[model samples]
Target chain A: MNYPNGSKQIPRSSQKLNSNETIFSNRGMTLEEDINATNDYYLDACLAVIHKKPTPVQIVKVDYPKRSAAVIKEGYFKQASTTDYNGVYRGKYVDFEAKETKNKTSFPLSNIHQHQVNHMKAVINQGGICFLIIRFAAFDETYLFQAHHLFEHWDNQFKGARKSIKYEQIRENGYFIPFAYQARVNYLSIVDQVYF
Target chain B: MNYPNGSKQIPRSSQKLNSNETIFSNRGMTLEEDINATNDYYLDACLAVIHKKPTPVQIVKVDYPKRSAAVIKEGYFKQASTTDYNGVYRGKYVDFEAKETKNKTSFPLSNIHQHQVNHMKAVINQGGICFLIIRFAAFDETYLFQAHHLFEHWDNQFKGARKSIKYEQIRENGYFIPFAYQARVNYLSIVDQVYF
Candidate 1:
């Protein structure tokens, strides 16, 4: 199994933890947390200016009480039209969506939406860096799969192809993103090697 | 007064409307709506992939019904750390905040926040195209003011300078954006001339 910081050994104290709990507790973070921490590191070092867009919520009603801030009384989550994380890196527009799946054999297409794919296509057409960060939690592995490569599978799915990308195929075509102490998901390294 | 689509005359039906009401009613849209429409035009034409980010909200409670979608019970608007709109344009990272002021004489510095300035500073340092779209509603004029020029005024406010940028200064330093039929706030025209 892959370990964070490239350390193969698990700490002795956590050896008794349940395997499922260990997936998160051992890593001390989820995929979202890891990416956020990495983005913070990138921002602090003046290396990039990436940020996760706020969750889209449709506000229906708001109450403005005297001497208090406005409070939303009714709201609902809205499906995002674009990727979750996006920003500028090295003068290029960078955009990507991060996902984590527990499946060991493959990454399912159901986790993504058509609009997000369409948005990624538009970004690519405009010459932006676009990709997906897929984490196979069962194996504790994360991969940076470029948008163009994903499009091939995404289109083939409608023509009697598998609804998911096999883990082996991902290993062959995607860049394995290594975890670091501070920058947990160092996807920019892959971007540097593949795009720059 | 400036007219949309470069027509000098106001429509006969709108001539009798109160001048203040005409600012929005006659224009039939706010600065935000105009910009959103312009972005849509750009997106439809595959010219750019810019979008205004969803409003930031701090959710406190949510209710999941038996069969219906989850609904947020309590939420509060959060001050955004970055600019309102950001996306890719001509293979470059573009970031900007749009603001409209009814004040005829100046654009107040108080309309902006320190954190946003810091965010814009970071974006500019990353070699991205950064600017502000300022709409002086009273004058029926909109201008594209580069972020660096705004930084000068933003910094001066702390150094015993006026807290507002005079209208004349903006007219002299900013590029006046023309209004089009479909692309109401055709700020990209100014972007092409100034940045490209």
Candidate 2:
């Protein structure tokens, strides 16, 4: 079926996670809402024009109450989006994906979708700035990894390499996004240093 | 209410046509979708990196079949969005709004939303490329009006000037984006000449 932006579902409903896969325990809110609020704060401060794309919810059913707000009652998880956040910066196009996990040792490969990885690679190939903002929420640390490096690791994984990307590997290959009061995730500073 | 980003909304609810209103008739497809397809052509040819943000729908109800997909059967129109298209080119961010009218003589100021106007101003202030692509479907003509000139006129219209911009005014204030076999709209060429 059709999803937002003509996204099609993957036929293979495959997963490495078992029936008892950790259900992504987190603080209080969904990782998406928190990152969205943070991005909103960043946008409000005029430190960056970045904004998170809407969650690609597959709207399967809805109830439009007369003179009331529409309430979503049923839906399915869509194919994870192609990009999490995108915006323009200093006249250049900037695009990225963001994810946070409570895992302490490494980020699980299952957290990312194949389509998103493909999209990030395409963005970089087309000469646009593309990266990812990865968070170790348990440690409260985040890093911005350029798309090229992500593709390298992702490709390696496809060839039967490590299933999880280690924290040390990220720290070595990724650019740490410096947190400022204004731009909470000031990925652009790193973008300037690396991609430009 | 949310729409992806830079996508416009047509208020099928409120439309008032005056004698001076410009008219543009198309093949019954959404201007947004058509432009999206056009942008895709541009992207494939390495001409531009633009996209239409998903149509923001405030879904109220959904239904999930046991083995089927979730369907959005009820929803309401979302608030008007900021712009119609935004992307990167040559390390620069490009942002713009697109509108089409059936009137041949003039385009109505009412076609634009206040928040979108504000967004264009902000983009300009932040040094991003901002503009409006006005298409007169009746005449099959489209022109790119820089946010600077549009803002000046839009602001003046609030005081006691033209409520609707004349076709001659658009010709004078805007640059024409040439249509091409590869790039269709070829908007980046205009961006290259004007913004870059």
Query: Best candidate per DockQ, number?
Result: 1
lDDT for each residue of candidate 2 in B1-196, tens digit (9 for 90 to 100)? 2121233422212245687976443346555656777788866666566776654666665657688766665565476456757776665777888898988789898898888887787677667888888887765556778888788778999799987898877876676655444444556666776665
Stretches of model 1 off by over 4 angstroms after superposition: A1-26, B1-26
Alpha-carbon DockQ of candidate 1: 0.75
Candidate 1 has what TM-score? 0.88
Query: Share of real interface contacts recovered by each model?
Result: 0.88, 0.30
Q: TM-score, B chain, candidate 2?
A: 0.80
Where is model 2 more than 4 Å wrong at Cα?
Answer: A1-31, A56-81, A178-189, A192-196, B1-30, B61-65, B72-74
DockQ of each: 0.75, 0.28
- The best candidate by TM-score is 1
Q: Residue A190 CA error for candidate 2 (Å)?
A: 3.7
Indicate the TM-score of model 2. Answer: 0.76
Worst 10 residues of 1 chain B by lDDT: B1-10
